[model samples]
Target: MSEREDFVRRFGGVFEHSPWVAERAFDRAASVGLTAGNVHSALCNAFRAASPAERRAVLRAHPDLAGKLALAGKLTAASTVEQASAGLDRLSPEEHQRFTELNAAYMKKFGFPFIIAVKGLTKEDILAAFERRIDNSPEEEFETACAQVEQIARLRLRSMLPGEDNA
Candidate 1:
């Protein structure tokens, strides 16, 4: 594959289903050098410069946290690992039910899945965030969700290209 094509293939899904972000970032990467931190900043710059509608689509592309897709084994491999890292994959039935309810309420309120980078957080931490964020105004929630999406992408990029210098 060509270098751009290979770059896209490696990083395309960094922002959930949004490959365009990676494609755009590759253009910036050509000039900036493709170190992990530069690639991350390039990717995030593309994401932030996108129209609000595009950003919202990226947010909507995310699966609900510990929701039906996870239960049905349909989350993307990255999502599966990230959620599992936070013990979301091993929730008790009661915990699962609580997550389900919170997921529903958050989506209903915000028009997108409640998103928090779950890497180091426990289920209780996630639930607390969900409960608290569900009360944000639409404008506030949109920005918060977008920021969370960026955080998720950062974590994914860091995992793929690990180094203290990458931070």
Candidate 2:
């Protein structure tokens, strides 16, 4: 495979199950270039160019933090590690139940799973965010989820490609 193909395949999961983000970035990289410096921005642009439905699909690709999929070990490798970093994997039963309740309520209210960039956050921090965000209007929460997805993509890209900072 070509380097661009390799790049896309390797970085595809940076946006959960959405490989289109990587593919779109690679298409731009072909004309310009791919570097640790600019790859995240390219991907973000690709995400931005996506249609509303497509963007929603990308958001839907992400599993809820500490949701059933995480508990069942069904999340992608990147998601598993990200959630674990927030100590989600070691939740107390009561905390787990709380997360479960919150997850369901948030999804019911917003029509999508709640997302957070959990890498640097404590579980308490995540829970606090969840509580506060649940009160947001659906439109506000959707925008928040999109921004968090971008944050997650940047973090995942950094892990796969060294020397990257948020851009």
RMSD of 1: 1.1
> On a 0 to 1 TM-score scale, where does candidate 2 land against the true structure?
0.93
Q: lDDT tens string, model 1, 98-127?
A: 998988888888888999999899888898
> What is the TM-score of candidate 1?
0.96
Q: 48, model 2: CA deviation in Å? A: 0.6
Q: Where is model 1 more than 4 Å wrong at Cα?
A: none
Instruction: Write down the worst ten-residue block by lDDT for model 2.
Output: 28-37
**Leading candidate by TM-score:** 1
lDDT string, candidate 2, 1-167, tens digits: 98877977877877879888888888775566666547777888899999988888988888988988987889888888889989999999999999999999998898889999998899999999999999999889888999999998877777776765544
For each candidate, what is the lDDT? 0.90, 0.85
Give the candidate number with the greatest lDDT.
1
